[model samples]
Target: MEILDWIQDWFKDNCDGNWEHGEVIQITTLDNPGWEVEIDISNTSIATMNLAWIRNDNGKEDWYGVKIENQKFTAAGDAGKLKFLLGLFKEMIDKIEA
Candidate 1:
């Protein structure tokens, strides 16, 4: 699966049964062959924002930043190095909400 597909799947799995309102808003791919996927779930009671970072085999690492204000959460991760960014994301969200 492509990076975007993987990210979408991840989000779907983690959306906490809030899938229809949450959506992938924008996707931007970099020249470094890295990619960014943005998800907007603002329509819900809580505003949700997600960014995905993608990097290839090179030493460089990309970043994805996700923000959720209404529900209280923030997220980011290095795509090239981490297995899955969910841990980082949850931590970030907890910090923001806390």
Candidate 2:
């Protein structure tokens, strides 16, 4: 599924009023391009995750950064990295619901 679709579906399936009241997910568009995504799962079983895409970085394209657990872990990569991150989120949701 498309990332946006997955995001919507995930929220629909997981949020139970309180999560939405807490503002669990946020997305903002950068001035240049790309997006800044913040997911607050700290209240949940999983940790918080932040994702941002750099328009241009030292002549590199598709540069993205991810910080988890308030920078307890960090990574930089491309779009594929976001896909992997989403997969991890799905797994966490499944585990928590199960």
Candidate 3:
């Protein structure tokens, strides 16, 4: 999964192994045939945070809803926050390429 790889690389680059013991758990799929992803960052001292992604059942196939600490923050079409989380890694990858 590209997201997994990107997350791992992000930790390696930005977190200084703080997330070395982190895990990405695949939670149950909803009836909408959407995926649920759980990201654990408890190993880091920064904060005991857990993030989640719920694939939207609507026609917006590329969109996802985001949750932090089980609290819904962003709707499917509003991916800015999600991208910010993913962008932490994407920025590093971009630097490497630059």
Candidate 4:
């Protein structure tokens, strides 16, 4: 719940009127029974980050991946990983801030 609150706050923080019109964030379900998150860093604080993708595939259902493409931060994981992937994004942001 805390992470979700933080994510809402982060979204609010980035809502500069203009950025909000671009559909900067998207959370969708994948047909493969999973979640997908795409956040457009655009002119935000993390836009300049050059972080590499993160992937973990321990087994069939225990798999996830994250990466920055163009100007968007993208991630996907199994059905139960929605919050976990968000947490990973938070960790990346925290790491940058730290």
Top TM-score model = 4
lDDT of 1 by residue, 1-96 (tens): 554565556566556655555544444555654444344444332355433433233245655555454443433344452334444444443455
Rank the models by lDDT, top first: 4, 2, 1, 3
Candidate 4 lDDT tens digits, 1-98: 59889999988987887888987879999987899999888867678876578899877688899998788889999988999989987887888778
Query: Between prediction 3 and prediction 4, which has the larger TM-score?
Result: 4
Off by over 4 Å in 2: 48-60, 70-98
Which consecutive 10 residues in model 3 have the weakest lDDT in total? 71-80
CA error at residue 97 for candidate 1, angstroms: 4.0
Whole-model alpha-carbon lDDT for candidate 2: 0.56
The candidates, ranked best first by TM-score, are: 4, 2, 3, 1
lDDT of each: 0.45, 0.56, 0.44, 0.86
lDDT value, residue 57 of candidate 4: 88
Query: Which candidate do you rate higher for lDDT, 2 or 3?
Result: 2
Residue range with the least summed lDDT across 10 consecutive positions in model 2: 71-80
RMSD score of candidate 1 (Å): 7.8
Q: Which residue pairs show collisions in model 4?
A: none
Which residue pairs come into collision in candidate 2?
A: none
How many collisions between residues are there in candidate 1?
A: 0
Q: Output the better candidate (1/4) by lDDT.
A: 4
